[model samples]
Target: MSQNAAAATAGPVSPDDVAGLRAAVTGPVLDPADAAYAAECATYNLAQPTAPAVVVGATSAEDVAHAVTFATRHGLAVAVKNAGHQVVPSVGESSLLITTTRLTGVEVDESARTLRVGAGVRWHEALAAAAKAGLAPLAGSTPGVGVVGYTLGGGLSPLLGRAHGYAADHVRWIEVVTADGVIRTVTPDDEPELFWALLGGKGNFGVVTRIEFTAVELTAFYGGGLWFPGEDMAEVLEVWRTWAPALPETASTSFAVQRLPQDDALPAPLRGAFVLHVRFSHLGDAAEAEELLAPLRAAGTPVLDSIAPRPVPDIGAIHVDPVDPLPYVETGFGLREFSVETLAALVEAVGPGSDCPLVTVEVRALGGALDREPGTPNAVPSRGLPYVTFAFGVAAPPDLPFMDEHLAKYAAALSPWTDPRNVVNFIAPDEAVSEAEVRRLYGAERYHRLAAAKRRWDPDNVFRRNHNIRPSSAPAGD
Candidate 1:
């Protein structure tokens, strides 16, 4: 090993080492002792906190490359954080953290209907920019989520996902700083293999600086949520299971049983109550949207119905995801089919009177364009899976007796219908994903291919702080 590498392994990073990092990059380098360190390290899911030896507030692709090069020379792990929505607990004090929040930039090509967004740019920013051009990017439910990270995880958007597929599939180019300290502009034509790997590969290979992706020529959508009492969860789910599959490509739908806290911010009906929220987004006329949703509306009376024609910029309002960061435990699994048995199991697990401590249990219907393969193949796995079940529990100080037990029980109950695989995006922050689970998530063939690519792009495994795809020749380490 080099002298720097030996020194890095010998003991904790000294102030001089941090000073060297600061000198190497034209960005702020923060040590743990710095006053701003804690705020810079704060993540969206507070449950997976990280304490890196140094945090680099990256302002440009060059800064990212400098940080990666520094980490490589010092034999330190490198981790990238934008919005810090998806957490990987492996990034600890031994690693070098690069925060991309300073790299917020957005450029739109109206004629091509494309958007180029910086790593730190959130969905709402991109949406607003695209909306000016009468276009819409495939953004997920939450507007606060970082565009780059979300796209890397095969972003499942609310509005046009069933019609357009994942946001990763729409990507045209990616600007990344690889482990070798090289700034690469990845596309199908330029470094095709790396391009494919980076799409759904997460941050294992490099820190992405910017992404250029296709946007839809859409200005508005008729979509929103309908809230029913907790008592009607089973019936609502049954109706949704049937209704969602029958819906056309222009529509995407999901249902969630939300046990909302009694907060003043919440609507009067939803505050302090267990309610079932049915979210629907249609890319067609308002009248058609209403007509298509008639059956679900007829099934029961909703205490709150906000379904109406809305501008595309306001799409995030449909899901009503929390805007502020909070401590939460999330777990999810893909299902081959939402069978009658599976529906029953779901109701038993979190429906009324179950006393489930989970804040919300959601079932999203997947099919249509999401099932279809993209023109250019990428790393996104589990395309044909029909449904996904996700549950969120608040990470409160007073431990609930049923937290782990209920989660396991819920998974076991749906095991028969559940696919052994997982959608990478839905993987929880603190979830322990084993090698076997990785193989199950990505098929054996794809997993091996991803590993081969990892070997080529990040041979030393410097960027291992993610849903890692370990190089075939390298020993897997945390």
Candidate 2:
């Protein structure tokens, strides 16, 4: 073994050795003792905090490669963070965290109608940059989410997804630093399998430093969110269950049962309220969109309504996801279909008198382009799924028992419609961790192919932080 490898194996990395890493990289190499460590490791999801022995605040792709090289030499596992929206819980001291927040770059190719952004670029940033050129990327429900991570995990845009498919479907290329410390520009012609796995496989393949995707020609939309009293959930949802599925490819819809907080962040009408939020988006004339939305609108009284034609940048107005970190447990799974029975089940679980304890339970209608395949094939697992449900509850210590029980109950109640595979982005931190669970997520054939790619690109399983796809050569149970 080399000097560095032997030295690393003997014990924890010595101060002098860490110093060597700091000197090699063009970024801050922080340790727990460093005064800036805590701030550097903060996460958007307070429920799953990140704690790593070492953190590299990478400024560029070269810095990321250096950090990966440093971690591999020390036989340490690797984890990555950009916006820290979905941070993975660190295993222990043997892991190195690479924070890509410093690599904020956004470039719009007006002629080609494409967007290229650094890993740190959020959807809002991409949306703003693309708008200046009359194009748009498939940004998610929340504008604050990082573009790279969201697209890699098959980003589901609440406004445009049903019309244009997943964000992963439009990726033109990806710039990633693999476990071997190599910076590679992956494309369909040049690393097909790697490209396929990276798109829908989440973070299993490598740490993506930058990504580029074709943009849509959208400048505005005819939709926003509406909030109705919780008591009207059953009635509104009844109309939605049948109405949403029949929406044209130019339209998309979703609704959530929310027991909101009394925080100042929420609007006056929504603060400390129990309400049903109905979100809609249509790439069509305002009159036509309004005609399509008439049935659901007339079903119940809307306490807050903003469904109107707005600029594309206001796409986030459809969901209005929280802008601040809050302690919560999130889990989601796709549904084969949302039939009348499924609606009945949901009503039984969280309707008017159900006394559901969860803060949010959202069901988005999925069909149209979302149910179809992209031009080039990718590993996105949830294609063809008719609907997907995302549920989350607060995770305070005192609320653990009730929350856990209720969450399980909610999942069990919807099991009849549950498809084994899910949208990769919504898989919870504590979920799909086991090998069998991950296999079940991608299905046997797809997971095996993903495993083959994992074997080629990350045989040692260095990047096992997110919803890990183990290499086929590894022990089955791992």
Candidate 3:
């Protein structure tokens, strides 16, 4: 073994030792003194601070393997950051960070309708590349999110999700470097176990280096937004629930009730007061899409209507999720069915009459594409929930405690309707749900197997920042 490796094994390697290790890797190595360290650590979401003991700007898979080897040898923790949208804190504390942002590249095979993307490439980057070949992947509303992170977390896309399914359903293969510092190519045919684990498994199994997936031929959607006045809350919620399920598979929609902060950047009508914003996307023609959405559109005289035939990349404008980073507290639950009674309860809790001045209340219909089994053999616990509803609480100066209380009450009120199954993407840090709740999110059999997989792949519990599954031998209730 080398002197640096021996020294690392003995104790925490000093800064000089880290420099020696950096000399071995091909990528840019950053320490505290590095001028670009702060900028490099900043995420797109801007909420997360990527303060790492060491940051490796991985330009290739080989570079990642080197970082992994170095981290494992020194008994250091590791965090893989791409777009940094998952702003949960302490995620990258005193650990070695492998930032994949520089690895942004995309390649498309037109005839195969498949695209291979670098781990750091964002959805918009891949979409632009795929569009050249008249193909598109099942991208989410915000195209700025990294492809590897979103898809690995069971990507919930806006394009034809009902008819097709989640973005994870279309994955062809992935290249990952395991915690043991071994580089492996994962496909359903090759390492079926790792392949299944990597999909919807978050960053538990390994650091994904490359992702290959099939794309859709879609160019445009008969989609856009419908805005309603604050007074139409009761009528709009009831009308949306009744009319939403009846719509065909070619359609997907979300109802967002929010009080847009007064800003000169936004239109006057939507600036201050609460508003019911209904956003929809259809696979077919513009006119038929309009007619199908007419009733909901006519539910209330709109303050603003931007609904029309537009490019897929522009879909983020429909929900118009706040681009700026602000302290946010969110809670979400998937329901088997949002019955009329339950809808009424929700309307009372966070709707127009409620004192909750929320940032947004979003309800996404999750049956079509998200309901089906993924192409790869993975342990995606089926929650059997038809709709997933969430409350994003963003207050001035960000009231963490109040936000938590409000969301807990909201989840409790809907407990009767909520299915235990959780999409890993929606799992937040402050959730007080029990182990039984987690078991409910992921079925009994699958959760057990995932725990088993964790035992085999990551025995020491190195990657426990995510929704963790403890090993069987670890004392239960200790």
- lDDT agreement with native, every candidate: 0.84, 0.86, 0.75
Residue clash pairs of candidate 1: none
After superposition, candidate 3 runs with Cα above 4 Å error: 1-10, 32-35, 44-50, 92-94, 396-398, 432-438, 473-478
With candidate 3 superimposed using the best TM-score fit, by how many Å does residue 379's alpha carbon deviate from the native? 2.7
Alpha-carbon error at 369 in model 1, in Å?
0.6
What lDDT does model 1 reach? 0.84
Q: TM-scores for all candidates?
A: 0.96, 0.96, 0.92
What is the per-residue lDDT of model 1 for residues 216-272, given as tens digits with 9 covering 90 to 100? 999999999999998997887788888889999999899888889899998899999
Clashing pairs in 3: 165-369, 420-440, 420-441, 421-441
- Clashes (candidate 3): 4
Question: Candidate 2 has which clashing residue pairs, if any?
Answer: none
Candidate 2 per-residue lDDT over residues 355-380, each given as its tens digit: 78899999988888887889988999
lDDT per residue (tens digit) for residues 130-188 in model 3:
87787879887787778898888787776567877877878988999887777888888
